[model samples]
Target: MDSPICLIENLNGTLSVNEQAIDYLMGLEQKIVVVAIVGLYRTGKSYLMNKLARSKTGFALGGTIQSKTKGIWMWRVDHPAKADRAIILLDTEGLGDVEKGDSKSDAWIFALSILLSSTLIYNSRGTIDNDAVEKLQPNRYVTELTELIKVKASSGASSADDEEGSGSQFVQFFPNFVWVVRDFTLQLELNGKDIDADQYLENSLKLKKGFGKNISDYNMTRDCIRNFFPTRKCFVFPFPATVEKMQLLDTLEDKQLSKKFSSTADTFCRFIYENSPVKTILGGKTLTGRMLGHLINTYVATINSGNVPCLENAILAMAELENQAALEDAFVMYKKEMEVVKALFPVDSSHLSENHLKSQTRSTHAFMERSLKDTDGKYSAILAGKIKEYANNLFEENQDASEKKCKALLDKLSATMDHGVKEGTYSTPGGYELYCDHHDTLMARYRAEPNKGVKAEEVLEQFLKEKSAESSSILQADIKLTENEKHIQAEKNKTSQMAQEKAALDERH
Candidate 1:
């Protein structure tokens, strides 16, 4: 356990500056993700961490673990690509040592804490039966660890699970274990007696006679762990030679296990992100789905596609529109509220530092940036409003001085184009040309008179009547077609009636 802690301290020292920088970036709406690097002491934990640090920036300045503090400590590591985002790794101590009493107690406590906080790393060099697994009597540490594993595994946060402790008092809590066998090299111990390493039956029979009930319980624990964490998270590592290795130690300082660590780290942090209860509450408290849909529509249709100089220009446009500051403040408030949300949710998943959250996924910060730029986050509306404004400006600037001048220009343009839509022509402004297009298409079809089953006059009259009824204002509607038509007559009568009612109402007032 101290190994993981020592690793944490070293990682912390290496990552401090990067952490500060990331903090600043996140203040400007960035995200940072941090992961914990855990394994037994002297298992190259420090060496591997140092290598990772060199690939990043300098060493994190956090000191060695004191006897008083148990378990792993967390520290941020620099990310070469984006300084604003980083991976923070935690170091945990090795398990099962008898010489150091205080250290042993600390290790168990620390391991238990890791169990409670992190997605466990059953780190091993080669074979599983080392000094670590040999001392498996009934103890509090194993009980706690078993319980913690169950919690993480059941939540879909872990890939492997263990079910070996059946009928035992503490079987319920032992989660599936994973064999994190690194640099596979097999070593077998011999017992000077007639015992075959390959033969499990003989070995069990021998153990039953020699070790009694204690061995049985040990076997139970061992079998449980083996069955639970049966899958392999195995990797091959090249071992260095003697003097050549001594010189290459400097190179070791620069080498990192990012390829090896990335998947584990992603799973760990994601577990924290998913299982944390506050996320549920936050999700529930979101804007209504209809409002969010409208917002997305506005964003995609208008703001994102609208012409602006840059992010700054967009900001300025939003400010001019009067919701710029509100947008920015909304994002900031969301971040603050999310932090509180994280605190409320106890992540019994993997223990990840803040840096890992940002580094692992670039989209987190990208989303934040987009949200900040949104004017009330009503993106679709903003875009539509901007386009409408631009069109209005153009229409105002290009206006004709008098109705006669406008009508003459319109007539000339109409002559050049077909009565119905030609290949291309601008009639009405905006997409409201759908109305003009519909009318023109009807008129063209009416003139063709290819079909005889339906009466042209009747069809034309019905179309005009429907259009007139749908029209809210007479000036905006198509008022005149032929001089004598029933639809036209009806509209004229409706307009006269409306005028008379208005005149009477005005007189009474």
Candidate 2:
């Protein structure tokens, strides 16, 4: 998109999906790496998203204390480091807006970001000190995720127990955690030893050795962050410019910004592009843009309906929609390919079978590519049945075509003999011998005809049986034929009939 669009809108404490944005996402065929940013109001989240989109201005960056971005805005761009992939950057509305006066709504927004993103960035300012960490607890963000999201649709554990144990399950489904501390001026040192950004984050998250209420509250947010998002990263950005110029940060060119900030921003973009994984669900089923679109609707609807969003339910819903689509796609491909062979009607049985097998293989591959969570092979079985039905229909049509063509050829070859029979030309003393000669010659011409298909021998056998009575009557009426000679001719006719029937049977088998 040229600019970001509102994917989900929060209006008066209620969230609704934007169909326009969902439609755009549905059109993308590539796998996506979703990165969502969330933090307190006025925290420079949109700026980072704009940079990741490779645009100086995309997501709105406000210069005021009021939250500018409401709900979630989305910008989709081609992935820089991965082939056939896209990067979807989500810039959520700033959390903790006083005017909003809705902490529950903010929590839901936070939960949605976690559910949708492959990399979730908790954008904060100043430092990763105790005060800053506490802001991520309670009415802030991370601590509310458990209340806002559920791992399973229905659990046997009580609500209190479920919440306690659900944090461990969040690690399996949560995004890679990234903490971006803007305007950070503290030195990266612990115990007088300089440390890297990751080590600094780990140090800040380290729990204290105590068990009182005060100590437990102090460790709560840190423990949640560590336990819920096992894979974590940190980036600390120096102040971009003076306070006066910071208001105009969005309009400033890269050269105009602080050199250190610019360099770190570039590195951050590179890291995100290279390291963020393709979005996936349970069973490691990769999600495409279409699947992601379905997910957005499912999660948002669940939230709007006053129910905690469940990852298992969402995946099940997505699987049903995707599996049905996959089945249709596979069946369509099979039909398209088989139609090409159908045009060449009356094909040899072996030729038709060979093409059917090839088409079936291609169709199954197509189905497998798009299908997910088909553990019971339900969709696969459906596709197989449809393909088998189509193959049977095609074979029937081929047989019918062969029968029509062979019968037409036989009729054309017997035209002269039919006219002679009607004229009574075989009533003379030696006419039976002449009749036999003509009949043999006609059979030879029919056998020499090419492309008669699988039904060639069967049709010819039927025609010969129909003419047997006529041939017998003609042989008995011949005045020139002696009893022994007549007997020999009858035996010869019987042998030829048996041979023709056997040939037809063998062809069919």
Candidate 3:
């Protein structure tokens, strides 16, 4: 899209999906690499998102303390590194906004970001110290995640048991975690030894030994980050411009920004473009933008109903919707391909059968490309049955077409012969020889005609049988023929009729 749109709107603590955004997502067929950013209000989250999108004007970047982006805003851009994939940039409403006065809503937003993204960027200003860690502690966002999302639908077990099991599985579904410390001024060193940004982040997340309320609180957030995310990365950005120019950061040219800041931004974008994986479910079924749209609707509906969204239930629901779409797509492709062969009606049986097999194969491949979680192959079986039925109908139509065309050709060719027989033109003294010669010439002309279809011989046999009585009468009236020659002619006619009957039988088989 040229610009971003609000994907989810949060108004007075109520969240609703935006139909326009959902429709846009539904139209996309490429696999998505979703990267979502979340942090406190006015943390330059939107600015980073715009940079990632490779556009300065796509995501709204506000200079004031007030959060400019409300709810979740989505921008879709072509992936720089992967030709077959697209990148979806989500700029969530800032967390911990005092004006909102709704921590519950913030928690949901946080949870949704984690649920939807393939890469989660936790943007924060200043250093990664105890206060920053505390904001991410169990008392704030990390611990509440277990309460906000469920791995499965409820059983008869207790809530505590369910939470325990769900916590262990978070890493299986959670996105890769990235910590972005904006306007970082401190040296990257610990105990007089210089370290990289990643090592510095690791040192900051280190758990303090011993047990106490403070230590436990400190360790909880660190442990949650380590356990829930399969991978973690860190990036530190120096101040981009002077205070006077900071408010106009989005408007400034790249040359106006600090060299270090611009270089770091480039590095960060490169890392994201190169490393972020396509969104996938538990079975490693990659999610296209259309599937992601369904996922958003499923989660939001569950949240609106006051129930925690279950991963398993959402996947099942999405599978049903996507599988039906896949089936229709495959069937449409099959019909489209068959239409080309249908135009050439009355084709040879082997030719028609060969085209049918090829179309069926292409349709099956189309279905397999989009189908997911079809462990029982139920959809595949249904597609096969539908294609088979369509093939049978086409074969019957071919037979009907062949019959019509062959019958029309025979009627046109025999019109003159029928008129001559009715006028007694073949009943004279030497007329029997003339009649035999004319019939043989007509038979040769009929056999020489092209494109008579598979029932050619059968139709000819029927026409010959219908004329046998007329031929016998003509032979008896001929006065010039001897008795022995007439008997021989009768026997030859009988043999010819038998031979025609056998040929018609072979064609049918």
Candidate 4:
């Protein structure tokens, strides 16, 4: 069983900087979707998180409400219903802790939760009312957090998200918000109609203003909630257990806690595991283990330095880094593949063949293309576009390498041409048979390569011309030998007739 990595301690504004933590997150082979909890302090937020994580003793459920969670804690656990993905449980410090004394900290906590989570569970005690919605003034902090967190934006646009043209850029980072109400003792029927939680929320949001409040930043707290979480959902849980009853238990698995709240908790957990999709950050990446450390650093550094985090920009920075790393890895593998292709060529010319080399090169190239496309990750269109460019460069690099090797083989053939010709091995009806055989071999070897250097055509033409000239010289020498032998035979026949006449005269005497 794998454990969770404490990504950040907000109390001191320190992220977990250890490589072990970084490696553990990076090592996750599954897609990650985060489910985070945030509401008023001691609202059983950590305990609920334990249920989701399926851990009896994790995330430290605070008994006395001095705020158990300081900054943010994340644990990677297998999704109960998803075999292909994992859930990153983000347990946040609760809001409205007076001893903390800073409303700004509360705002930062919410911002961080929204930034990191896919499905944010807004856990609160008692019935859902105007006050609960008012406390979560999502519309109020658009300008404040950008400066407080100090994230380096994608465009490097110094202007905030509220700056006229940046709205779309900023809005892409909002989370899917789920408002989970606890201990709701009110009736579902209103005026002879049965209303579910969604209808109840819509009716509550229908009013533009709440009693005694002008809705500070936006039209009203209700409007802000509606606008902020466009893809919103609501869950109402019966009082899981009394605060006094919960404090004494060691874990959610305790018989008393389970007996009272098991059914409601089971339903909530089922919704999370079955319904939540893998959350993508900035449309380019999921909040995976590999990227967790960098995000933590960005958030912690921005908040600690008193710079409001502009998440859109921070995401841009992370994606650029992620894409670069992915490309470099692909590039290395591409080179190794070419190395294998080069080895397929025979070391000496004895086993040289043309078509096989071409076939192998084409196969290797096709494999490279497919592999590069698979590297198209979270930032699909943009990262894939960049990968295409890198792949082109790789294709050219491999082609150039093939041409170099082909020229080297041709050079070896040229050196041996003089020796083979001098031995008259090239003179025959089928002139230069050895050279022709090797030529076919050379052509086959580079059949899959482009003619970038020392083209096969140019080498073949020069070789044939040289072989023809050598054969012509051999033919002229044979002609001279025949003419000289005929002249010698004529002289020998005349000398033989003279000798026969002398022998006849001697016999008559």
Candidate 5:
């Protein structure tokens, strides 16, 4: 009901919200196919799309000469015949409208539609003729495609085989070009025999040109469409209703309208439905919901930069951008989870604190690694791997910071524990149990991450080595001091006894 996402601004030439569109597309979980219509302004293109969509109120149908579809408009719908596919219907701004003359902008809209569609209908209002055919496939339009390939090739945007001006590049995206002649005044029967639309189209194609200088260009242009287009389909619809009837359908209500307007173009609708491929892309890829913006940006950027759009080059661009998008999404997810892990670190500045930091760092890095490795669509393995490389760097960087925290914690704990042992508060080995208790508490928390537990144990062992060295040195000095004190006490006792004995003997004499 609300207008579909406008891919391009018809007059301003701005492409909008492509990333949102691309994301929406990838989430569809269904294969995407496209059907599009392109023609001169006021040729019933919008109404045709409305019919194709099997809806009456959705796509706007203009009553006046002004074009209703100002830019490229798209509607996503379920494929009529296939359950596994989604069909994207595109209604383009008409070319050669009175409001906007046939300018370079018109050419871009025309070319872009052709590039994006799987089944492209070229709508015209009159009988098919040399002039009609020529107008439909203008020399400029054909040459513009070639010229674009030229620019793409010259700019080295395309590879060797698919260079600009090469048939391979331009022809790769050529849709099944259907020439739908809306009003046929001429006879379908020639000399009392039935003639199919294809036969009639061939007659127009085979018509010889009148004498004119440089008419060769016209001939060549026609021939190019005939020769290079992968497939050609032709259909001629009898004039649907009178001009008065058509205008009433535009200007008046059903009660205000004639019954002639109510006559449905049933056979025409059926033809379109039946002719529509089950999956328009069939075996080839063109229109998919996610790739829409990439395709538009690829061409729009090239055209806006005053260059030409090439198919393979566009594909390459899509690959790079989509990969980058996935990488960015993964980082966002990783950072959010890392924040949660960081909050799990111990608050107190104690022996257990270093283990918390180590565990947190391990958790953060594991979160990132898992995010980087998980991908959909095979997403440029090289670029995805580059992101993995970045995660590895983060791991190393966090380890360095956590290791510093661990060493500082150990040094501070060593001083406090050492004082307790020397001051007769505990036995020398008594503090060992307390320190090991702290280590065990944090180590148990990291059991899910076994490497983290191992790392914490190593840090504890290193701290013990420093503490053991200081304790062993002090204990050895205490042993020597105690032995000397005992020997001096024994000698003093002997000296006192000898002095007492000598005094007694002298008194007796």
Candidate 6:
């Protein structure tokens, strides 16, 4: 097949139609799961949600914080162009205190609603005495849960089916809690003894005697919790939000910390994955709506384009002629590397748009052509002369600057492709140095075999190999396109029924 058309136009078509399809899929609400982030105000609840969604909306909520108050928020996430996943994030007001009248009852009500309907992601910074923690006390929140369980049990609603449907996990206590001691350290007493402070781990007994002094405490708090909820589970993760060493902790990488934080995160994910109703919510089967949304997006784009192969060929030719082969390669690599990037720093697909992708592709194409041409273009003589004059203008001692500029450009082109995409990094400056160490490498090769030297064909071969590797990156992207076709077929099958439903709903409205 005459070299299939490039992905650019195909992607464009896919994106355009995908937008409407997403609306329809989301409208179905066949499998919706709410995930809530609750904790003390300013304890990074919104921040975490924003991190998951990879948007600044949560950050905007932080900016709106003029003072401590209680307000619930919600966010809905759709699949990225490359993946088949959707998430709905929920934000509950800070639990312990509301700015006004009795919030205890209201707080408990909202808390229970979340507990019943969603997976709970309580803030790590909310500790034993943390206002949020206090609000979740057995007498308050858990007591309510206990009573609900008791009522359900008496009403014959506590059968195995009910237990499975309730979808709660048992408790697993996190070992160390960080106390934010911003720029200052205070003495912390443990078990009536002044514990010398640097970093220390207390045993479960110590924790019981110290923080868990009574049934009101967490460990024992589970006992009272168990009295009502023998089948339910709980967990505690202590986070210290100190100002003193905040910079050090925040800037530290996972590799630097021996995966302490990563381990904790894994445990949290495991709990969610294992829990019952939650398993159903996050399960692949349930996320089909979102997955289908992505499929529809691609399909619509495909139909609009009408001839995938022709479109791909045109785009590919333009990209290659423009020297953007590497750019195309980069996008493909991105599909494979999404999971890696997310682990290093969680991101949402919101920041990535069709316009952005196209822009990046075009820029990279231009950059590549410029890199090759400047090094050995038809205007080299005139360009060198102009550069010499420009360098002379900088200062009397800048005669070499012009020559250096040309060499630098060539050097950069040679170096492109040495490194994989950086974690938490979305884009890279395009050119040769980005590809590999061009100058030294080229010079070394030239010297090594002055007579039997490399040719344009060899260089092109290497470049093509890199591009091919990228093209092979993610099966998900390919599968997603196929899924799009499936969704289109499904829609066609149910078109009449859908039309009737829409007509009835419109009449009611």
By descending lDDT, how would the candidates be arranged?
A: 2, 3, 4, 5, 6, 1
lDDT tens digits, residues 342-459, model 2?
Answer: 8988999999999999999999999998998898999999999999998999999999999999999999988887888889888766778989999999999999988788899999
The stretch of ten residues in a row with the least summed lDDT in candidate 2 is 155-164
lDDT of 1 by residue, 268-353 (tens): 33443332211000112222212222222222223224321121232234333334333344334434543542443322122222
* Candidate No. with top TM-score: 3
Runs off by more than 4 Å, candidate 6: 1-26, 29-33, 63-71, 79-85, 112-118, 124-135, 148-220, 224-509
Task: Summarize candidate 4's per-residue lDDT along 82-160 as a digit string, tens digits.
Answer: 6888888988877877677767767877788877777888887777776666556533443433444333354343443
Q: Per-candidate TM vs. native? A: 0.32, 0.88, 0.90, 0.68, 0.60, 0.32
Give lDDT tens digits, candidate 6, residues 189-233.
Answer: 666776532222122112343553463455543343333333333
- Of 4 and 5, the candidate ranking higher by TM-score: 4
* lDDT (Cα, 0-100) at 471 in candidate 2: 87
Q: Is candidate 2 or candidate 4 better by lDDT?
A: 2
Candidates' lDDT values, in order? Answer: 0.36, 0.89, 0.89, 0.63, 0.61, 0.38
Candidate 5 displacement at residue 94 in angstroms: 3.4
Candidate 5: which stretches are off by over 4 Å?
4-7, 10-32, 64-86, 98-106, 137-152, 155-169, 184-221, 239-244, 248-291, 294-323, 326-452, 469-509
Clashing pairs in 3: none
Query: Which model is ahead, 2 or 3, in terms of lDDT?
Result: 2
C-alpha lDDT of candidate 1 relative to the true structure: 0.36
Query: Which candidate number would show the highest lDDT if scored against the true structure?
Result: 2
Q: Which stretches of candidate 1 lie over 4 Å from their true place?
A: 1-34, 51-71, 78-86, 96-100, 103-119, 130-132, 135-143, 146-184, 187-215, 223-232, 236-238, 243-509
Number of clashes found in candidate 1: 44
